[model samples]
Target: MTSCGCLMLEKVEGDASAKTRVKAAPGAGAGAWCGSCAGDWRGRSEAIFPIYVMGSSRESTVAAARGIVDSPEDPIWVAVKAEAKSEAEKEPILSSFLYASVLSHDCLERALSFVLANRLEDPTLLATQLIDIFNDVMLNNKDICRSIRLDAQAFKDRDPACAQYSWALLYLKGYQSLQSYRIANILWNQGRKVLALALQSRISEVFAVDIHPGILSI
Candidate 1:
């Protein structure tokens, strides 16, 4: 269903279930998860709890719900990634999706969703785009994004409270061409091919995240 910020309780697309769309109980505060069911609300907007449960069949729905409520402690990042995959399918409906899952998912999932959703064509703009959304997520959805930036910042040895959350460390690894992408654009007027290649190898070893070679070559 189309949303305009306020909580929406529309039926799922093609849903065959007889259950009615549920709403938060009266007087429930923000980030409160109240429903007819006995389960506790895990997300910020009470609205998201339902959408997260829109998978096929009751079993799948329960499994999806568990992903959000469970700790990121087991299997580490896998649960976070599972939640992300669920959110990704609901894109462009993201404002509502994010609002719904806000409290359910952790800070890391929130920041990463911003990154995954906004991936684009221009290689040179990658870092800038990541930082821009990171800031927006931090400023606009501080409750969710704050801890993520702090965690990412801690990895870089920077103060968690720092406003900018310089993405240098996060972006620096993975693809070989990313290093080249940065250098190529930074000194666009001056060429530095050799140093770019060296940076590429360093990224591969450290991040284990691969860059599309074609993206770099271009």
Candidate 2:
């Protein structure tokens, strides 16, 4: 097993409990790191958190923060906006200043919504979708004019100057493979026998994470 920080990614050619041997990073606490690190939906109580507090709607920020802390398992959650009844409360809202923050990126919206609505068993596919969305938004969202450049600059400043600096790291280290098999395990646990079998083959080809014969026997 290879370790990063306190987290470990096991090389389970096909172990039933392979994923359960690892721990999820604090940032990834909400999402299942693997089999063993499955945590409750409620947020972690760790003192250090990853909340982006740039220029954004305070209400939205608070709501988003609360959502992350409160519902770790949720991929998406709807927040209620407060309507102003008086002019004093109706201050003109400016554009979002959280342009470069990973959490604030609009590409994450769909996956979040999907996760919140359903206790999604697999975030691998959703994570891939999020990456594609980010690429599309960064390369083609033309309405923002100069803001796009500003946001792009911000991301460059905040992140390492590498192609796989973001969540794509999941694929680089074969985390995506574990996620797929975990999803398949979930389906198998849920008694969706046919679907589980179908996923097994797909996951093998896509992730290249082998399922060992001994692990399968479990």
Candidate 3:
């Protein structure tokens, strides 16, 4: 089963009891499984399920999707790095800062971890310690990692002033504060209440955005 430049729902060769596997159709450029649909279809016995595919055939779709998911560098990170490099070349004063903040890191999570740690750090809570915590949380939790990029994309899309994704990531205090709160919330859930509160304090002090770490509403 396939559609023109769309998703291909194919039945896997296996026992009848086996769950169906889903992938992009060939020529489907960088396909992604729809979250709601995936959740709904998970563990079901049905062989033919509805999926949304943007590109073409089964082989190419699967390959493209795999490349996007398995690849260490994503489009968002690549764009941010390119923008940073361009800005660095144009403005000599910001070159060093851009290098340290965006260019030096391999991915959005690492760069964001560094930026947030530095922004929230103080005499008591060192930047190194915060980086470890942030990196641990962000890298370990794939959802958090995805959300960071989505938030960066949102800033670029929604804010007229935000000309580049790197600007939103590096300079937006609101964005920083939001990400800090996410980490703090995770800490609170993991029973690190004291550390979460400490992060909350730093968030308040630095970004002037007061949010309780205990708040589950992200």
Q: Model 1 scores what on Cα lDDT?
A: 0.38
- lDDT, candidate 3, 101-205, per-residue tens: 999998888999999999988988899999999999988987677667666766775577788888889998878888989999989998999999999987998
Pitting candidate 1 against candidate 3, the one with the higher TM-score is 3
**Residue 114 in model 1: lDDT:** 45
Give the lDDT of residue 190 in candidate 3: 88
| Cα deviation of 55, candidate 2, in Å | 38
Q: What TM-score against the true fold does each predicted structure earn?
A: 0.21, 0.27, 0.67
Lowest-lDDT window of 10 residues in candidate 2? 78-87
Q: What lDDT does the true structure give each of the candidates?
A: 0.38, 0.35, 0.77
Indicate whether candidate 1 or candidate 3 has the larger lDDT: 3
**CA RMSD, predictions in order:** 18.9, 18.2, 13.3
lDDT by residue (58-162, candidate 1, tens digit) is 565456435434545532244334544555576656646443333244454444444432432144435455445334433454333323433333333333332
Worst 10 residues of 1 by lDDT: 168-177
lDDT tens readout by residue for model 2, 34-112: 5443231112311122242233334755564455445545322111011111211443342121122223434333322
